[model samples]
Target: MPAADAEVLIVGAGPVGLLLACFLGRTGIPTILLERRSSRGPGSKAIGITPTSLEVLAELGLVDRFLARGVQVRSAAVHADEDARPRPLARLELGGPGAAFPFILSLPQVDTEALLREALGRWPAVRLREGTEAVEVRQESSSVTVRARGPSGGETLLRAPLLAACDGAGSPMAGLLGLRRRVRRFPVAFRMGDYRDESGLGPVAHLYFTRLGSVESFPMPGGLRRWIVQATGAEEPEPSFEKVEAQVLARTGQRLDPGGRVWASAFRPERTELERFRAGRVVFCGDAAHTMPPIGGQGMNTGFADARLLARVLERCRRGGENLENLLALYEPYRRTGFRAAARRSRLFMGVGTLRAAAPRALRNLLVPVLTRPPLSRTLVGHFTMVNVPYSTLSGVLARERRLRLAGEGQADEASGG
Candidate 1:
């Protein structure tokens, strides 16, 4: 209704939103980032940052900050069945020889947000408004407007040329805009807790597929470790440390002390993807656009890739002589293509660890060892690190297609003597 307040308005100041804001802000773009929470929330949500994400951060010169504070997970050992002297079925090394970041950086989500927030402060063009929630959204041809309620119970209208909804899986903006999401909730649930690292495994991650269920142990910062156990569906959603400890011990034969626990929770994994990523001037980013099980650790990293691509699109549209329609038209299809590939990768990782039946479990045990060896292991690690996935913009895809089409035409011209 009124003149645009900023070039871009971002909903949800989570990791994805913050990073998106930083990316835009670095280019001196005017952005308004909104968050409903009054302050940073607690809990270690995502612990693994893929090499691709590190490269994205490296663009903003913040990778060193993350590398300084986060743990480097260089390898993960896969083991089958619990034994007194349990041996690994296979040990897969992360990051190839020519990789920019040779390992997955393990940092809690809170710290990651803090680092992004700190970087955002460097750009005065971007303003982050906390304790402000978007209640209504109106999109027109020229711009999008959002009616938000502040902490004092007052409504304010903020308009922007573009709106990026990085508000997370339960994004209210997606609902307000009537975006349709295809959601599939998995039957299996899991409980995880951060505890002191007593596994003597050092920086390596250990994944155990036992008769009971799957147990994953990963190294975290501050000499802490995170353990995730597949829940039996009877435990409470906010499971106690004792429950997690018992499951880990039964599955991996690793005795865990509840007293050493830092944080714990239980959740049923789900995959949700929007049918369309854009509606008018509004665009969905991060978990607001797609969500996958945390088992594979691609959810947030994929969102980072989304922000990277979206930033490039917005930057091009802002610089002039670019058809914004042509750019935005292929955004959803290209991102959905990448999201589906990443989702399949997540499902592949889940399948091996979550097998229950004797036949499937035995097959997985036999297959994992072979899969984690030499040439094939590089492919698996590439999937894990996301270095091999085509998590990029449609601009590149279109360019390649254009090249092929032109080449075909050139050949046809030569044949016809034109």
Candidate 2:
């Protein structure tokens, strides 16, 4: 963003922005990227990637690096109670042709970003300027003017034919444009921490849907683990690590290490979608356009998908003036549909995982069996694993909405409908 001009000026240098840069670089498109952060932030967030996402990585020739560092979780385990035996949610029975590996993979968002940065290092056309933050953006008939500040007290400017705001959920570009994105904040708070421990917990991830609250753990690369425990949003932000561990133990009925903590933070599972993903010469991508709960982690993966589609759409347009009028059209339905769909699904998962209230927990415990029918757990587990995302096409969303409305009598039913 510090240059006087660029072909493509990307807003954020997070996973979405950098991966998009790598893709455009591979496809021989010149691009420049800017990020607000001086360096990678603490904490391991968004640690899951689906089969469809892996396929896209394969297309970028970056899957090998991810495959090298990530664990191929062919199966997942979800339990109704802490000590209750976990069950296989979904087995990777099918991956369409040209797909890269059929199963889901686990790699921290940071690790994914590192791999993308390395890939971008190979391309000379792609320039990355970290420690830079965008404060203003102005779009004209043929170009965009972006003003930014460096980590130090330095000012910079970038002029480009096109602009992409991948700056994340709190997108300045979207806000400045007066774009109102719908953000549905759940009345739930999850405290997540990463640690180093090789426990009896198997290779698969664990989800405990207990009456008190949910306690879950996910395995990361190099003997590291990511754990989450629900907290009542009403009480202060979150009690403390001691409180988090105590509740985690109470729910799972298992002893856990409190000293192995590497990173800890509390976050709400909220979903938001930009009202308009495009403007004159500026557009939005990834978290800038939409963000959802980190439950299934479709957040980063979905953003990566947006970057891929957007870059391709721009690449395919007639090569005359490169005004981005045609490419901007592809940004909406392709990305918004996925963002909206994933947000709705993650909200449903949040309800099931945390079971926020006693009444809702009882309602679910009683009704889930009736709805899922024979082998109820066996059938419903697939929904939690994100296996049904791509397989359940948009056309079926309306039908699924009606079915959910008739089953549960509340907002869960309504939100799932949208």
Candidate 3:
């Protein structure tokens, strides 16, 4: 019950941690955000930002900054190699009048982090220490203490009532907490890069399902486009501009002469989620909690949702003098369930897109058109854009409201002697 260094000690300064710090700081709660990396890295890791995430940013008054720097994707087309003229198997329209931000936005992760950092500057209570790595953490009955090494190899201890872990997939904190993880790796690898887009694809995202594998292309904010191709047989092949260009040509019969290549890398997709999202006083968020395949682009957006909800819970506890433990107890189940659903959806997309057999591929290509019409089409769009994710505290609020309403009605009926 003694005074701690800060109200919350947040590990990692990615989108999740940065947004959490901003939220807590705005609520007048002291926060310390630590980042091992001194600077943001190059290239885009997660490009698709969902409408729900935009709504969360709007609540924080930071959505317009993102809107100005991102490209709006209104439609997506899925093409198969069976057609001779590059006909689309199915086209999903993302823009509609029902939603506030009708379409998904494509912005590089680096840019997203920079904007978050800028937003965090408005709050004077947040202390961000870059190039500081957390090396040790200790949890006591009433407080948590973290030992970190600075840039100059000096050690310092930081204590707080709560700890938020957003350190990513290879989180040392998760290991230190001794949480169990379930992970599965895909058999295939992918090569992805950002290139000067001269293909005239506009703002439409394209996915080509060929005999070899799948190729995805999406427009970026600048005059660039991101392309991801499945590298099935090449075990150690280098991901260069030529490899991606060749794959596109072989699959879709469309030649793309990329003007310049900015970034390229090969990676094997893996799905990972922890058994639980909390341990003692430490709570997991973002990649620290769950990691999914990049097929649906739900990874970062889901993390943003986690940070948003956790901020709300923490703020309520801080202001109302509520028990922090009771409020935080709701976070893990809500977020874990959402992550399971997202991982399942992502896995299904990966499986369908990477089908190379004739029977399954034929069935998928034939049924895609029919399933992508009317009601079914809307569901597909919702899944891809993550608008359908129910990872907020709204569900709990609605349930509580329903119970109160029922009780009031019962009292009214009793009073009437009915």
The prediction achieving the highest lDDT against the true structure is: 1
Clashing residue pairs found in predicted model 2: none
lDDT of each: 0.88, 0.73, 0.86
Q: Tell me the tens digit of each residue's lDDT in model 2 across 42-159.
A: 7667888777677678888878889889977654555564235333232222333344575568888888888888899898888888888989888776789888898896987789
lDDT of 3 by residue, 130-227 (tens): 99999999999988999999999999999998999999996789888788899988887788978888888899999988887899999998898999
Ten-residue segment with the worst summed lDDT in candidate 3? 392-401
Write down the RMSD of candidate 1 (Cα, Å). 2.2
lDDT of 1 by residue, 307-344 (tens): 88889888888888889888877678778888888999
Candidate with maximal TM-score: 1
Segments of candidate 1 deviating more than 4 angstroms: 82-85, 234-237, 393-395, 404-418
Q: Which stretches of candidate 2 lie over 4 Å from their true place?
A: 1-4, 82-99, 318-324, 356-418
Per-residue error for 206 in candidate 1, Å, reads: 0.6
> How many Å off is the CA of 299 in candidate 2?
1.0
Q: How accurate is candidate 3 locally (lDDT)?
A: 0.86
> What does candidate 3 score on TM?
0.93
Q: What's the TM-score of each model vs. the native?
A: 0.95, 0.83, 0.93
